[model samples]
Target: MKLSTKELTESLRELILKGEFTSGEHMREIALAERFQVSRTPIRVALAANAKDGLLKYSRNRGYSVRSFDKRDIIDAFEMRSMLEGVASRVAAEQGMRLDAEQQARRACDVNDSLLLQNCEIDEASIEIWREQNQLFHSAILNQSGNRFMHEMMRIVQQIPAVYPPIIAPYRLQDLRLYNAQHRKILDCIIKRQGMRAEALMREHITGAGDIFCEAKPN
Candidate 1:
């Protein structure tokens, strides 16, 4: 299928985060076009978009290459994201979530609950499904925050390596139910308008994920 520019960007970014492309490796438009089964135009635009997100470096003649980030860099970015997202949660709780946003979050949690019901075995397809729903839950909270700047900052921070929710593939094989539980608590806090508790829970949730990511990351 021909992917839109936004879809292409997201797909490429996810692959990059998953280590499909190594650090400092240059992405060739032709290769990506063939891989994604799309024309070079979308691939080109996607690469440029990722570059803007700081996931890739662009040079006049070098095109785009994956930017290398050590564990510290990733952890630091996640720290910032945690604080920003925590504030978002607090704001959303204080202001109250829209009916649609609350509904969307509940749906995402229910879908993930079903996914987590499987036995301890984890697969690529399952991970992909979980990632999608996880992103939906986070997006609902960010949107509900009613702060555009916070939302935009969360967007940029999440683009960092090992910081994006979809990058949780490394820890998925472990105790993902814990994360789901945290999600439920966060949702409950927002619904109950417990701003401080929601903020603290969100901070811990994000930092906990970061810790796991760093541990699993190769030295």
Candidate 2:
């Protein structure tokens, strides 16, 4: 019920990313304050911060509303993410991934493989597990990269709904398996200290999701 300013801001951000608030939906201070059980002052601060973070758009008279992103916006965000994640993968390979990080990535891939074997078609529950493992694999590499700037930039870019790992996981078995196989190749390249190959694979891996999402966009 009680949340610090940072917590409040992140909470609101998570709601936006999860599509709990639709694009172009307006947020009211009074309603949000009541919902979060916080004072209006903190709600105002949180709203302003989110607006600054590009999650909300502020108008002269209309206050703050969820920012509407067109297909181009999503595509551009994904492009940026692809570049940043590629760099992370390359750096992780050059630095030589830590033993613990390697273990984490390998375990994540193993779990994903098992999940795929168990489900011909991924259900909602299985999708959640898949997302968790996907995040684990990616994050392990990013953390091993040891680049704080890239990490911060990734946090910003991935705030876009479709660019987040959870949103990028495809429900279809064929597509999901394709992504998982790429993960294996990327990790193998990184472990072998092939920085260029790791970087290229990582870029393609992220870009593949972008292409799928853009193609699915309504005309």
Candidate 3:
């Protein structure tokens, strides 16, 4: 099979998100090119693109390495996300004109319900599913805000190293359950047109997740 540079970039980005490639690890161009069965040109292009996306650090002479975010970076990222998202919620509410937003929010809630109903413990794959749905729900609300700056800021924040689901070896079912429950509550608030409540819930939800991520340190 063949892979495009964009596909290769996405594959490497996912590897970083899943913690397959740890921070400070150098990405050997030849090795990656050979492994992906592509030429070095695409590999270089992919690395450059990922670097621009803030997923990797590139130096003219030193090549590319995975960028690491410390605890403070994670906290700051969440803080910014919460503030922007809260504003987005308020804006959406004030406008009072978002049929598509309401639908997307409801669908996101339904997706979470399906996942939670499985009643299984949190695993890598399950966490990925939750992350995808959560992102969709948040994005839907932001899109409704009609603020291009807010959306662009969130797009950048989502690329941060610690923004994805934490890679805890012993997955915590309780944390997953609690987070999912919060998602349901937030959706309810949005559906009921309780804009302020929705904003507060989202802020707490993001900050709470940040706290949990910090506490669940790598083993």
How do the residues 1-219 of candidate 2 rate in per-residue lDDT, one tens digit apiece?
A: 589999999898877876678778889999999889999998999999988888899998999998877778878888999999999999999999999999999999999999998898777788879888998999999999788988888887877744233364434688888888999999999999999999999999999878887776652
15-70 in candidate 1: lDDT tens per residue?
88776877889899998888999988888899999898888999899899988787
| lDDT per residue (tens digit) for residues 163-217 in model 3 | 2344544336676667778877876777677889888988998888767776664
Q: TM-score for every candidate vs. truth?
A: 0.86, 0.91, 0.84
**Top TM-score: which candidate number?**
2
Once fitted onto the true fold, the runs of candidate 2 whose alpha carbons sit more than 4 angstroms away are: 161-171
lDDT of 3: 0.76
- Would you list the clashing residue pairs of candidate 2? none
Question: Deviation in angstroms for 143 in model 3?
Answer: 2.2
What is the number of backbone collisions in each predicted candidate, taken in the order shown? Answer: 0, 0, 0
Q: After superposition, how far is residue 110 of candidate 3 from its true place, in Å?
A: 2.3
The better candidate by lDDT, 1 or 2, is 2
The C-alpha stretches of model 1 lying farther than 4 A from their native spots are 1-11, 34-43, 163-166, 172-174
Q: Summing lDDT over every window of 10 consecutive residues in candidate 1, give the lowest-scoring window.
A: 161-170
